[model samples]
Target: MSVVVSFKVRREVKELMDKYRDRVNWAEELRRFVEEKIRQLRAEENLAEILEELRKAGWSVPKGFSVKSVREDRDSR
Candidate 1:
């Protein structure tokens, strides 16, 4: 279940890519790059949604909370 995707590149860019045609699988390279970009974008979108929900609920930490918590955990260990 796959479809063809195509785009045009500058003439110089195409020439450079053609030079390495035997050493590279351009289709696979483009596919992996696109897949990785989509994953990164989705993760960012999810993070933004979570932050918005926290903001709406007025969620926040008091000043020095991180330092105090870290020191307490270190002392216990």
Candidate 2:
């Protein structure tokens, strides 16, 4: 399912776009840009939620915990 989406650009911008109309797929380009932007925003929102959950749980790691864990894994390999 698809719907019509429209927006106004500056006259200069519209003129520039028109100039390259033959070389560019403007609708696809705008759709991809909007899709990417939505993905980026969703990722940020998900991260914020995860961080809030972590904060509520008061989770913390000891200093050097990551380094020590990595060293142990390498030694076992």
Candidate 3:
């Protein structure tokens, strides 16, 4: 099943799209873009929830812990 999505665009935008419409599947491209954005938004929301949980649990990094230091430590091992 498919749904129709209709939106108004500037005349120039419409014209530009029409010019390349035959060269591209615009609707499919738009669908891909929308799907990727949706995934990104959901990931961000999940991360926010995790951060809130961590805050409630008083999670904190030790003063000596740093990404660079950790990388060096791992490299030395």
Candidate 4:
């Protein structure tokens, strides 16, 4: 089922969305992106153990830096 929803976008966002119009979808696109990322991370070496080590060391990640986002950027190139 398809439903319509509305939200406000700033001028720059509208420009970028138009620039990438072919890649834009409101619903399942984000879900797909997240799912693919999870799959890729699951193949990494000792990912869970590394996260536990970070937690134990108390070396907090910088504000607004997501591990998934970093992985996606690295994989994109």
TM-score of each: 0.79, 0.78, 0.80, 0.31
Instruction: Go through the candidates in order and give the C-alpha RMSD of each one to the true structure.
Output: 2.5, 3.1, 2.5, 13.9
Q: RMSD in Å for candidate 4, one decimal?
A: 13.9
Off by over 4 Å in 3: 67-77
- Mind giving the per-residue lDDT tens digits that candidate 3 earns over 1-77? 98998889999999999999999899999999999999999999999999999999999987867987988989999
lDDT of 1 by residue, 2-77 (tens): 9999999999999999999999999999999999999999999999999999999999999999999999999998
* Candidate lDDT values, in order: 0.98, 0.98, 0.94, 0.78
- State the displacement of the C-alpha of residue 10, model 4, in Å, after optimal TM-score superposition: 7.3
Best by TM-score: 3
Q: Evaluate model 3: give its TM-score.
A: 0.80
Ranking by lDDT: 1, 2, 3, 4
Higher-TM-score candidate of 1 and 2: 1
Candidate 1 runs further than 4 Å off: 66-77
Runs off by more than 4 Å, candidate 4: 1-11, 14-23, 46-77
What digit string (tens of lDDT, one per residue) describes model 2 on residues 1-77? Answer: 99999999999999999999999999999999999999999999999999999989999888999999999999999
RMSD of 1: 2.5
| Backbone clashes in model 3, listed as residue pairs | none
Residue-pair clashes per candidate: 0, 0, 0, 0
Ranked by TM-score from best down, the candidates are: 3, 1, 2, 4
